[model samples]
Target chain A: MNSEETITKASVEDIDRIIHEPARLNIMLYLYVVENADFVYLLHKTGLSKGNLSVHLQKLEANGYLEIMKEFLNRKPHTMVRLTQRGRDAFTAYRESLLNILQ
Target chain B: MKDPLLEQVQNDVATEQQYRDGIPRIAAGFFLIITMLLQMNGNGNTFVMFVPLMPTIIESLRKRFTYPRIGYAKVRDRGSMRKYSLWAVGILLLVGAAVFFINQVSPGTIPQENHQPLLLMWATAIIVVLLGIMVFTSRSNIMATLNAMGVVAIANRFFVLGLHRDALYVVMIAFGAFLLLSGLYSLLSFVKEYPVLTDE
Candidate 1:
């Protein structure tokens, strides 16, 4: 393989597949802009259904990309989500690699 | 190449649900009107005390009204906030210094009778400009509001250029009223759009 092909392969490989999903990408993008957000806010902003969002959030939490907290507010369950430091670094790397590949 | 996702992120941040409630604009409007009233009543110095409380008031109101509807999300402060704040303060000081310089250079240029009102007008202009910069973060129909503010600023400049003393009050009132109406309209629309979510 040529040097250019090798570079392209490296760039593609650097992409974080966990964050590359569309719904989770939307969640990450939304969360990235704010310090923290509740499940309802994420649901509203990401336009993801409850089940889908919960699943993606769980995957992200499992990957150590998200920190989620659960509490009862007014006798109703409320979940707050924020990005971990690892998540921010990973997202930044993923973005740089994706841009490099596109370029 | 421009990244569309980044653009969308910026758009989303600028038009966040918290900013959509028009609380900032409403607070700005109240501040302007209150300052104008205080100046008119010869209690101008008291208005300064209210400046520091503005943010607290807005935050409290948001907690009470807006957060319940859309949930809480603290936006990450942009670096530009400090830059804009510094620019606002610099412009305010520059205006004050220029006025002082003019008075020292030629006391006759501005009649002693008009000096106090002129200072008040300049102060009002500075407040309007600062509010304009602050509200630019929302950027939701703020272009129209900013354009209105721009027109007032430009017109105020024309009055100052012409050395018209009485025209300043009219300009200040007009700009303040515009912000008041704009904020009221936005707040009404926001309330209509987002009813408070009941506890599940």
Candidate 2:
């Protein structure tokens, strides 16, 4: 590849497009720290509507960034979510990209 | 992209770090009351024995009960708190044991009225410092203000107005009971707020 092509490719690769969305980023960051959290917990913390959160969570899960589990609490559905190892790595890469760009 | 939503998540994580637990507060309250009971009997050394155990007990209880429902996340103090906590405990113990030793040797090294105030001062200092660290680390304005009120209350009670030992016990008992009640309230609140979803 030409030098110009290599430079452009590297810059494009730097940004984690999958985690670039704001809502999904927030969810990923929250799960990154807390390790695991309930859907309601994330809903409250993120201040996202139930439908909106479920949508974003679905996207992250599709990308294998997180794992969502369904449990029955008091005979009601409880959704617990955690970032998979792949998700953690992506987050770390994203943070580094931000730092690199800022620097 | 520094947006309000990202900021909110950051703030929430900080809040989680210093988030107060009702049950732990009650455990501390109980520990304070028990310490006061020992003080009432003039049992100095024994108080120390039980004092350190309270936090461990409270943590265990929290893991079993509060964690399953609400979630569990610990603040990463980055080892600063460990050093500060150890130093603070050592200094307080040294001061306490010195006075006790002096009293044993001569029977009145520290006047009876003075010891409580002295302990209160150390406690207030530690509380202020720890809460100050929490304020800085957690970036919570509430903690910044809360410690100031605590310091002033201690000062007013013992420094400005003398409190007899009986009054001291009463004060500690009231504080302890407040903790216990707060814990109960938290427990109830948690149960209501986050009911058990499913065993799986």
Candidate 3:
């Protein structure tokens, strides 16, 4: 392949597909900076609908990128989500890859 | 642009961590006022005993007032607070031990005379530097205001020092008042901004 084609292919392959989506990326970035946060906090920060957030969170959990815990808070159901160790590593690597690609 | 999303996320996190609740500021303001009061009454050393408890007091206050309104999102550096608290306690213990040792080893080795002006100047410098760091990190309006107040307090300290050395208590009172008022304003704004969210 030519240099331009090679660079494009490398960049494409470097991106982590799971975190490439805008919503999921936003979730990851938020979780990356915090130890753990509840669903309401995430919703408030992301400005995403409840259903949309739940769906994305489930996707992340399925991919082993997030851990969602369900508990009772004040006699009400509460969901807390945090990035797993693997998830943090993935995010750091993803960030580095993106920076490399841009450069 | 160089990753606007990441930059924005970082800014949001810092804002959420520092400005989401004014509990720390309120607690700190109270601590300062109490310290000033004690100093004015010739019981300054007595209040140093409370310095080690300040972090725990602040945390408990935050738990009671802040968490209910804004859901908990433990920031990455939140653990560092405990470490700092421990350090504060350690430093206090060391200072106490040193003072006691000095008194025993050589009576009157330590100066009993109040160096209030010099002490206030040093305090002003330290507080300004800390407030400057807060402003640099968060760039929030509240922090900027606090930093400005710190600068003004430092200037006031110098003015008071030059005019009347004995009136150094005024500088402490003024600075404490600024912190108390600013904290009250922030706490009120935070309550209004984020009402207690009912779990759906």
Candidate 4:
């Protein structure tokens, strides 16, 4: 393949991996569409158990793809999450890169 | 499952949003009182006139409790609160301007005799305006709520003092206590809910 094709192929693989994990990808997608979501809300939407959701959320948060805030509601625990600027930008870029490869 | 605590939290969020939505009307009422006060011969008594409106404000806030807007996808998912806050701020400015015009028309009605109280009112109003600006520009809901409470407390205290009523001191102390407790609660909850993700 030509140098341009080779470079494009490499970028496509990167994008694919970024969005390949079902749990992490869904988390990103949900955050991308909504401005912010709490842990309960995310759990409800993703249909993931509390423990499972917590683990994946930490992974995304560790990558700087999400900002998490914990606050109490009626003395009980709660967690709120929102996508960071970098996360939003990266998600957009990843989608565009995948689209380019598909075309 | 069937969690009453969850229900209560939902109610609180709804109540807060409802109170926020009514800010425009509350601001208008305050402006009206300020106008009547400016027209009165004894501007010092202006604070006394504000007492009757206190019930109205409280009632409006209480109404918010029954109408919970929490957990719904539309209200919770979007940042629409910021937009509503901006609209309320605009309405407040419009009403404030109208009140200012009344003050200008009735010179000396403010009783230059004790400009200290009037100065305090002006300062409180300025602070409220600044807080409203912050609420409009930022996404911090908790900060906005605290700032709003400050606005109400300041207005009430100054107005009551102007009327020679010392009861506001008790009210202010209670409010301060409530804020301290709530702040500590929120901080602790934040720490517990999301342990720091260390893998960055």
Which segments of model 1 are wrong by more than 4 Å?
A1-15, A69-79, A100-103, B1-4, B17-19, B132-171, B195-200
Give me the chain B TM-score of candidate 3: 0.62
Expressed as tens digits, the lDDT of each residue in B1-200 for candidate 3 is 14577666756776665555655556556666676677767776666576567667766766566666666676654333344444433443564467568767987653445345344334433443344233223444345345434644654555545555336556656666776788778878888887665434
Cα deviation of B28 in candidate 4 (Å)?
A: 23
- lDDT scores in order: 0.71, 0.62, 0.66, 0.52
List TM-score per model, in order. Answer: 0.77, 0.58, 0.67, 0.39
True contacts kept of 3: 0.52
Supply candidate 4's per-residue lDDT for B141. Answer: 42
List the pairs of residues colliding in candidate 1: none
Q: Which wins on DockQ, candidate 2 or candidate 3?
A: 3
lDDT of 4 by residue, B1-200 (tens): 12354334433444333333344334433543453344343464455455446456544543342122222121233245556666655655665566557668987644554355444344444444444343232333445445554655565456645754233334433443554455345434534543332111
Alpha-carbon runs more than 4 Å astray in model 4: A1-20, A30-103, B1-80, B113-162, B165-170
TM-score of 1: 0.77
- Per-residue C-alpha lDDT of model 2 across residues A1-103, encoded as one tens digit per residue: 9986776668667798879889888888888765577775676556677788888999999999999989775676777888899998898888877766655
Which candidate number has the best TM-score? 1
Kindly list the per-residue Cα lDDT of model 1 for residues B1-200, writing each as its tens digit.
14677656755765665467777767766776777677666787787888778778877887677767767776666666547655655756786798789889988776676667656556655665565555446463344345434644654475558755445555555666776788778777877887665322
Over 4 Å off, model 2: A1-9, B1-78, B104-163, B173-200
Index of the highest-lDDT prediction: 1
Top-scoring candidate (DockQ): 3
